[model samples]
Target chain A: MSSRYSWGADEHLVVQITEDMSLESNFKAMAMASDLASQQVDGLTDICPANASLLVRFDPDRIAPAEVERIVREAEGRLEGGGPQVLETRIFELPVWYNDPYTNETGARFRDRHQTPDKTDLEFAAQENNLPSVEAFIEAHSGAPWITSMVGFVAGLPFLFQMVPQERQLEVPKYVRPRTDTPKQTIGYGGCFTAIYSVRGAGGYQMFGLTPVPIFDPTQELPDFTDFMFFFRPGDIVKFRRIDEAEYNQIKEQVEAGEYRIRQRPVTFDLAEYEKDPDAYNARLLEVLYGN
Target chain B: MAIEVIEPGLATSIQDEGRPGYYNVGVPPSGALDLYSAAAANALVGNPSSAAVIESAYMGPKLRFTEPAVVAVTGADIPVLVNGQSAPSWTSLDLKAGDELSFEILAGGARIYIAVSGGIDVPLVLGSRSLYALGAFGGFQGRALQAGDVLPVGVGSGRPGLSVPEALRPQFAKEMDVRIVLGLYDYRLTDEGMSALVDRPWQLSPVADRIGFRYAGNPLQWKEREQPFGAGSDPSNITDAGYPVGSIQVPGGIEPIILHRDAVSGGGYAQVGTVISADMDVVAQSAPGTMAMFVPVTLDQALEARAEARARRAEMMAALS
Candidate 1:
């Protein structure tokens, strides 16, 4: 496969593996990024892997632009011919409160910015997908596992793509106008990607629910976030499990008490197998996460 | 060994070379916007190039020194005042205990850097003293300096009379040509749009801040194509991707925004070009309403420019040594 990449000024490089959003494209990007990280090239300051592209930041003084480009191109060539690389990844089960009161109140405050001002974001999204009701939409969303394609837009905010086939994938447009305020942990959906707002700020995504767990902690107070302040990394899979407000409050208490250990299991993600049979692959991933 | 803020002018905060290596998790490398000036000030004050300094935008702070210390001011063309007396910029100066320091009204440029001997002894977050105010995590209390805020200063190894020559300093101008390497998603733009990007004169908008520099220019047009799956209806929106700092993105294909040191690592906007590293300091110095036209350069030219910039910093450090 011919991989396309470009120079981002003298200090950065952007390698685009594909034009559209797909699990294969993301997997390739992750593999390339992971491979680059292992090289430990001097002056390679940061490596950010997105849905279908990889951005590498380097110090021009320490490493020449031409040399860095050569290294990246070489890595891409090896990965292209090396066949599929199975990466050691983790699967996380996140507790979400669908159509929660907090998100509902937030949606009401930003009604003027939504396509359907009279309806909540969950309502509009459910109706847009031809679902019978909000409950049906919630069931569909929670039923399939989603893969974390990228982590950005703030710290630890994961951009998740549903693992189901294209036909079954739910899509929604961003807000007609961006909202100045969005509650932290507000599970938002836009352009076929779901993200939990890591920190409250300006956002355009349509809010559907709220997550009780914290994805980002600057203090690094959480036990799971000991090594890094952020919990989620690219290529990690997450299953958004719907829960009641009571459960949300219970998790909140545990989090406040500093006893909340995020439910996750280490697993290997085989992109080749996942692409062949997504439903079966996802079920196995779920079983690994829940041991059922 | 401290300075007390009598008045925290516009946006004063502690900054260094910025915190790198965190963009993967959406954390931007928040550091001094005009790195050249910041490093020059640090050199003048006998500190390492990465030492933390005070970065003030528009207006400057009024601080009273608690002890005798050496200081240097760089960036912008504004006048620096020491105890009601005007002082020369780009030169090291001695501040007696209880001596007050302030700045005159805005003359030109957007920001100014003040480096004290040793460096601002703020606790480092992620190995940087630079402030990411949006996250409230680093710098002096992770926010802009406030009135009565007392900042601890490192011991002074710098001596007065160490000055940077006028010939070595960057010229602050009302209009300039900022060089960029146009690529990364530039294919999304139309031929006409690509031409307009380099030809048009863009005025820096007043809304420009540390996060990004927004320019008011001719609306760029995009190629007509069926909206790709996962891409939004807007012509400028792409499937969310990583944004290199200094990369230019035209949202709605109208105003082009250049991401800066305090920008989000990635987003959904379609990027067309990245302002070269050397010109980023020039971009930071450009004040609101300044006219800036983008000039396209090859990778070799960008590298040459960066080499020249590194030479200047090395020269400054040698002079101080």
Candidate 2:
């Protein structure tokens, strides 16, 4: 399902090709080429979209592996000269609706790890993090459109890469037991940045927010195999604007009605029963517990 | 034409090849597990490769033919019968409106494919008739077949199927080896771990499906220090790379994951190998408690094997035609 772009420019040129084997290499190659393509096809710089790959957008006609190679070759010679690199990666201050319960408690003993070296009370830094909501964080820190990196190999799951080093510390490992399945609009954290699982399916990434708006529409394609339209590019900037609760509910209702479910039926076991003889039923229970 | 569902035996749904090109948006390419068998079933009945076949796990659904139609049943070796008579597999059959079709427990594979000549008349969701059970897209109401679920036969039969010869129907083995190609993180395993992966016979976990088939009897661990998956991810943890179909991934060092059709678009586990396309059908056929042995092959060998399989399949199709 993953395709590669051969060349990079400020605005991405759609090409098609037969996808061969190595996936990571194809993604890297497209990113490299698209970066170079921002320069003019001839010698003139084009004021095009400042990005490389359409992170998640792939159609029969778009940036496929074969076409990517040709694009790379076509734009290769002229890119060596100085071109106005218009790629100013826009920093977005995400507006966060932080629901963290105790802002005061978090400030009390938070002085352990993150110290500013000014000897200022580390609790003071927690106050800085006290953005009103998730949306507020987006509003303050990010001044410009963000640069996109790779798309999720999974559908609808946007994997935004290369967040500022300061935000790097916010990444954390996923929960011990991942959810069996989540909604399509469920935005998750992969420790790299935020991504929304555009479809309901299995995932191991840590969850952060919920975007009820359906990004991938099955109705639009309407069974015409060739006409399915999926938007978003590898280098495309995705600005997360907070939707109102009313909008969220409307989309949520639609999403809940019908969609694909890709998970095993979860079997529930009482914790008390398992605790009684955890090791006694290891062999027999393994078959039932893991369903393997 | 609609076929009335009398008894939706075991787990059943309609599937075609799959909905490809949606991994970027977190969608798994939901489709048939035993792809060759599914296609073979459709071809025998003069349907295109992309038809919604009835994917019945274990026991097949009981359907009452509503019109004169052509059909075939393949995969998983579930003993099928029409009015209590043994039915042929991988061959076309002409049925009447009064005929009742049913199946029993599969003796060999975990599932069997039922393809009608006209193809299943399912609403195209994202350009596929296949069902994605997670997001609940495609197929009969985007879920498994129910007692009252009636399937539509789309566009009736095409060209008449050639009389199937004796040798054309594929005979799947009760127990077999699944071929694998070393994955991106194959280097992370210890020699012993790799040896166990290929040499030992692992049992297919009951917890198997289109998403993934968990294997028991193997505790494959990384020779290197195991790290939590992610950036600043504990040193030694494998980052979440894309988990392709047939990927043999290890997480928690307890069970090995054999990813399948409905697998997540990505994962953080270490993918040690991938079952080659040539043997992916075999993996789909392995039933719960079935012994599964993994054998390694080089990239060149895998390609050659695939080519050979394609050629053989083509020859069969041509012969039957």
Candidate 3:
């Protein structure tokens, strides 16, 4: 078996499908993790997939690390030349008020830690991406759908990879120093990924907007969060839909009243077609989420 | 009747074996940092290995027991006192009703474990009684023990007089060797960097906590390569991936941060290596300013070390039984 992974102590095994981030690597990791989970291997606690790899945590006493390596290699071999997997996923339309007041207040408080303290995070990101203005940057950001590459820095925080061509993807550095405070529900962007602050704590990502809807409800108050506190799982698709402050306020009210419902649709993701025609495929994904 | 907190120490929280199986959602397995010490305390008090215990940092909590309790204190070089009378540590002692328990300043190590006959009777969240303070779930009221807070204990089954052998107890050292099985992105580091990691002595930073232990050491260099797309500009950054407990990552190649039990499950930084399971408890015991030396070992050695640890625990239990 090929050695394409790393051992984390005796308790964890990480299988690196690729060295870099790409949709193909992410899909491979997802497929392998899904296959391993189906095995219901005893003593295995978690099978977590990331951007280009997956990590398995288990009781070493119950299942030897060597055995884990053997099983993973076998599963990886089985997935070679395998056809595109049909992934059971959900497409969510998230409402965002870009450059909202909450984020503006928090970002301004941590200006000393930012790269471009004089300009807002949106302005800096726009200029870095060569966009004419913040509005244009917002358009580009919301134009494409993003896949949930991983869900973990903190609970329910999904790292999203944009579904656009390499050149079209936006990139930005994190804060020079992380802010001690970050408001919950703040939409943030760093590197080539996007995320929402699930719970207010400490964060370094440049804040871009604020989402009115909740992505994590620890109380399980929302219907979508009945079974779990987290709304988005790994491999879920999300599209950022711009909303006006008025609509944001309305949604906020509904959320407070516990009557808000996140707009989402059940969908199946085909990786092969996505690799061939990313643009058309992304458009169809959005259509499935928002189309009548 | 239950234990009442008169004063919470630097940081006192309820911990057990930890809530596993939820790292995928970013929930860390918040438990006693020093598993051996915790198990020793529980064993002394006639509780199961997984029984709840109070994990204290730096200082220890002052508690008033409303009812008599069989108690034991383990970890760190701190004195255990009952109503101003010094009591022996690592040995079970019976306390009468209204007996007040307290501790002295830590002479060494960072954490101490206090176990009562009955475990802390807190509602289990996600299947463990350990405290996840970051998310405010599990443990006693989902937070650290505060002044005036009351903690009920579970009905314990074992009797006192059980103590681990002196040879079995962990020996605290100012300078220690922490073994690692390098991988998960050690390839990103240059040969010099890899050598620098094991060759130098690293001092634990003052900011060390449950989430991670930050160490100050020589800045290492990374292999030069065209930064990949989606990967951040930082030389130490990768496309965010799952972080294994005990994994070591250097954000700027200056301070090496070792992820611990409460660490985030996944992130973007390139991890250079992971501390072997046997030494993770040692890492927890090291106090700030203590020096640590990284030692590289093979998988077979790591597995052998783990087996030794299990055998040691079995020996302790056998001696008590």
Candidate 4:
């Protein structure tokens, strides 16, 4: 693909269409012409992301409204050559705990939604339900990678894409009622993607986990970009591996001690039941979190 | 030099040309509400056009200068005096070490700009000294100036000064029409929404502060959007996004929320229009209940108007000689 998209003063708007979001192949298509994409365009704004279909922005003096439209359309069309653009991948193993209780259908209201309450009677629900715990799933699918796209919505919050098709799920519409108050490092997800609410306020994503990393900084030189280079981009594929608390603490210790490590792992699943289906784990966990 | 406040007038803070170019990161450039008056005061004191100055609202504070310095008060003119003697607005004056500067409750206007020689010495955050009270990050700990705040003054004040137009001084202090550009989302409203923005005179809501001034009067309708809540109706993030300084975001409420300095960077509510950069200072000075009508224009026209206003300010800066 010709690299004629970047190095312009004109406003450009690029759109990344995702019929269902986890398709990395289409996203990788645009990376070929990214070199020409002006930082003035979408991902380069103090807020743009690294890999996305569209990059839209305007510099009124250098280009007009119409030019912005033309340039972005050109950039979007050059996606086929995007495959070679995938570079190094950076992986972060997030640590999560499943201590919260998942209520079962009982004598309470709204119990008629699904099956009889069989899962809630067991302790160590992971073992009792004869299901793979989040930790087991993560262990089997460990080292799955994540790619960075353009930075969009909120400050320093990068949108990391590239989920495996088998692992991908349609993002459920956000929760109708947002949590009145949530704390920072709150990990949650919608349909096929996951995110951590970096700071506290109101949020609607399904909350399944938490992290301790601070995503924003005010004292850094750039105060924006840092040691992290959202490595995953469009067309990248990733899996999530569950780690035990001990493993998590070890990684935390390693991170604190400045140890760097990386590896790639694919996901696997036994489809006998949702407890065994890899894709259904998130929904099950969410069911536990919200309680059916 | 420092302005010792027995009472911090109303709401006060340090502001300058404002920090620009960081909007995409969710940061709005915030500065004096009245850029015209702030620039005028800085120019009068021989400081750069971007130097920081005092922003006072409703009634200016009782500032007792702890050191001798040249100063000019512009924008709103509350009853002011130096060492018990009435001081002239817009003109530079040399105060002794113990000169007492004070202002009574305002008779008119919403704010006043006090620029001292060398400008207010607050450290620059994101390239401006203007306070962002929302995140509480910039300017005097990102809070309003209060009594006993000993703000540092600039140096090299031994040089002499200039004067203001004796005839035009009063007229310059008077309220006037402020130009604006309807925002990109302007068309998202009904004909009535568009009309109420300009045709109907809206009054400054009594609720005002460094964060922003909430406007009252005229319920604008969005013919295109259907919702029970104001700006953050359903189809969107609901109630998110940072509020840029000078944005008018209305929720489901009839009245509009006019954001000002110290505003959040992003917001989800619909913004009908932005108080054009040039008119922001004027907007800051509109007292509660003052009538305001927003006018719409294209981007190019807005740029041209801004350039003309900049040239006009340069002339006024030179006019004091």
Candidate 5:
């Protein structure tokens, strides 16, 4: 696929792989970012890979912008063969309380900006996707594992895309006008991606649920965040396990006591094998995650 | 030694050259918005350019020295007062124990930089003392200075009479022609919209802060087309992507916001252009109600401006030495 390269001022060089989001574009961008990081080009400050683009921030004084562009071009050329098909990553089980009170209250406050002001965010989302009920929508959402296409917008927030085929993907538009406040850990959906709000701040995405686990711990008070403050990273696989309010409160207590540990396992994801028989492959992956 | 905050002003926080290498993880390089002035303040106090300095917004903080120390104030056209006596800005001034440092009303500019001989001794978080207050991680207790807060000062042997040449000092302007390198999403805008962006003068909105500077002007129109899949329905919305520091994004084709030192790393709004690195300091100096016109330049021209800025900074440092 053709990519467009443009300058983001004197310091940042942006490479747009596609105008639309697709697993192909995401993988390509991620591969290029990984390759550039390994090359360790001098003056390179940040190499960020998004859903369909990569932004390279550099110190123009140490290395010319042209030189940085040349290195990126070379890396792109090297990946013409489609780069790596498999990623050695971790699958995390994230417990989410759908139709929770926190996000529901937040959604109510911002309903004036929503497309369906009379309906809750989950109900509107379900209606838009032609799902029979919100339960069916939740099932479709939580049933499939999703890959983290990017991590940003705020500290530790992850943008996730379902592993299912494009035809089966859940799609919903963002709010007509953005809200000035969003409760931290709100499970927000926009277009084809799902995002977990790592912090309480302004947001436009439709709130669907609230996760009890903290994806970001600035204090590093939690056991999972001992090594790093951010829990999500690009290329992580997330399986949202639906939970009730009781479980949510229970998990919150465990988290407050610093006893909660996220359920995760290391696994190698082979794209080619998954493409052959997605359902069978996903079943195997889920087995690997939950099996003793 | 420590400096006690008598009054915290509008918002005062510790800043330095900033923490780099963390942008990919959504952490912005939170630092002094105007690096040139911040560095000049440091030079006047015989501190390294990267040393942590106090950054005050709109209003200057009221500080009392706990011991004898050298200090300097730079950025903004504000009157500096030491123990209720007028002091020259952009020059080192000696303060004895119990000497109070304060400021008069701001004459121009939006931010001020205060540098002590020994840098503000806040414990560094992630390799820098700059405060990312939104994330609450870096600088003093991961927040802005509050009244009665005792800030520790590092030890330094700085001369008390050093001064920066007048020519090297920054001049805050009520109107500015901000240079930008357009692209990264300029294709999304129509030719008329592009022209309007450069032709119109936008007034800086009062919402300006460390996160971003918003400008109020006539809304630009977008070219009609089928919305790309997974991109939001709004004409200005693109799939969420990383936002470069100084990038300008106009949501709903209104009120373009230029992300600053404490910028959010990525978002759904389409950024049509980015302010050239050299002009970021100029943008930082602009106070509310400042009229700014966007001036687009080629990559080569942008680089030339960067070089000129670097040379000028070097000259300032040389003069201080």
Candidate 6:
């Protein structure tokens, strides 16, 4: 419950929920951001909830900086009652082609910056986490669902945290030096979070796979992005389904023809219910997504 | 009527005040880097501050007007030209049909704001005409102007001869002290590192752009401690967090990058400090090779600077009116 409130220059007020990253911290940050947004405070431009912090951007001309701090403090106080953090969100089945050639080529090109130069990113990550093989790592990665803790570092990119206990969470360090290039739609990993690169650009995360479906379509040509260009949103749940290269190509063709539709379903995510037994809660959520 | 692009300069894009409220979804506030200069240009052309304008970096574009218009240029110390004849900047100039507009070599500053009487008419995406090139959604065709691109101009009742006084205009400098309000993970830096941030002058690197302005300087030192769980092993790394516009992050503690208007919303690097709001325009004016000395100030001082900047804008508006 320890939080540090600091100024991000004169325009932004950043509230650090905790020094460490955890699901609870992220929930608190997201809750606070949601609460602040509902208030419609004047001068408040953006309310960004990150891994373990909440950043509020405002205009000093419309409202005083001290007033912003006071309002945020009041919002933080409301969360002290331990209200049920229930979010009615959507669950998406994102197909990931693990150890794909695209990412494999990218990983090979940047081996000089990797911790294990001789091994692929998937193999190195599997070894680092004590998994028997890359196959085992894929199961561990795709076994459970992940929550979109934050969406940033570029347009439409979503940072995901696995829905598992702390001890079971897979941890991996980023590249020794960030590669100058990372293929768009690449599923990369760093620290305890996995990210889907919405667009091709410079990245520090370890390349593990690539997704055929577009998470970010600026043209909004895809059906999933009909209403918005970004396919993922904060609080959305994602289940990564491992697919072969053949399936990836099939989906890619469908996507190019604008006939592809992402598998998704609306569901309620309750923090209290999840805390009791994450595995059971996830099971029920999956049933809701796939149950006919 | 429309303006035809004869030559696309270094990086010319349509920009306005910016798009806000969508940062939570990773959409940056893509807008004019130097808001003050853009506003001044708009004011000269009798356009509202929110009207879309052309923001050219390093070099200016050569444009041909299909019809009569009133235009003004501001921001960089570049000379405006009308059919090869030198025209005064900061003053609205009348352009006849088929009149060609261009610019001389940039003497100072890195960007120029060109505001036409009728703002560049473009469809508003997410409530903005500003371009977020990385996202490729807003502005003209969701990208920078290319050769032979015909840009539609909105209708207006703007008059020529309006001008911003020389005394009120911003002055560019080779060596400038950029004010910063240090906080947000600044505690991760050692005392010596903090001292070095403000004591030494950092040169602007070539990597400077809309996303961020990178500075070359001595490596900063981080406080010794075990890397926290979920945080990377790099001494300069922190748990991924939100980055405010103008936030300064030194990745690997080597180069400090000041995230600008088009910056990513969040990242893993520790943001040691944020440039004060009043000085972001100053940072925008800096070109490659400019020397910037980071100066830390208290919150109260930062607010005072913001108030002063607001007053200056008011004065300029009153004069133009």
Candidate that would win on DockQ: 6
Worst 10 contiguous positions by lDDT, candidate 2 chain B:
B228-237
lDDT of 3 at A69: 85
- Per-residue accuracy of model 4 over A21-115 as CA lDDT, tens digit each: 32242234334234334434533332222232333344444555466556555555554433333333323344543222221111112223212
Q: Which 10-residue window in model 5 chain A sums to the lowest lDDT? A: A81-90
Q: What is the per-residue lDDT of model 6 for residues B22-45, given as tens digits with 9 covering 90 to 100?
A: 898899998999999999999989
Candidate with more favorable, higher DockQ: 4 or 6: 6
How far off is residue B130 in model 1, in Å? 1.0
Q: With candidate 1 superimposed using the best TM-score fit, by how many Å does residue A189's alpha carbon deviate from the native?
A: 1.0
Candidate RMSDs in Å, in order, are 1.4, 14.7, 1.7, 9.6, 1.2, 1.4
Off by over 4 Å in 5: none
Off by over 4 Å in 2: A1-97, A100-148, A166-169, A181-184, A200-205, A220-232, A241-292, B158-166, B225-229, B232-236
Q: Compared with the true structure, what per-residue lDDT tens digits does model 2 show for residues A1-292? A: 3333311111122221212212222234343345544532342211111112222222212234344345554553333343432322222222222222222232223323322323222122223457555444444323222334445555444555432323322344443345455445555554544565666655555444565545566555322122443444454444454545565566456546644211122223222343355334222333442364
Question: What is the Å distance of residue B62 in model 3 from its true position?
Answer: 0.4
Residue-wise C-alpha lDDT for candidate 5, range B232-315, written one tens digit per residue: 888898988999999999988999999999999998889999999999999998999999999999999999999999999999
Measured against the true structure, the TM-scores of the candidates, in listed sequence, are 0.98, 0.70, 0.97, 0.65, 0.98, 0.98
Off by over 4 Å in 6: none
Q: Which ten-residue region of model 4 chain A has the weakest summed lDDT?
A: A102-111
- The DockQ scores of all candidates, in the order shown, are 0.82, 0.13, 0.77, 0.10, 0.84, 0.85
Per-residue lDDT tens digits for candidate 1, residues B186-244, read 99999999998998889999978888999998899998887778878888888899999
Q: Looking at model 3 chain A, which ten-residue stretch has the lowest summed lDDT?
A: A1-10
Ten contiguous residues minimizing lDDT sum, candidate 6 chain A: A217-226
Looking at model 4, residue B185 earns an lDDT score of 43
Q: Model 3, A16-125: lDDT tens per residue?
A: 77767888788878888888989999988888888888999988889988889888888787778576576888899999999898899999999999998899999999
List each model's interface RMSD: 1.0, 11.1, 1.1, 8.8, 0.8, 0.9
Q: What are the chain A TM-scores of the candidates, in order?
A: 0.97, 0.43, 0.96, 0.54, 0.97, 0.98
Which digits, one per residue and each the tens of the lDDT, describe model 4 over residues B1-321?
566767687778888977665544445567887778787787788888788899887777878888888888887766668877887777787888988777766776777888898888888877788885643556776678888888887774523356656543433233345455554345457787677777766677788775677877777777644432112233322223233345576654377767665555443455665655556666677777776766655555655666666677667867864
Off by over 4 Å in 1: none
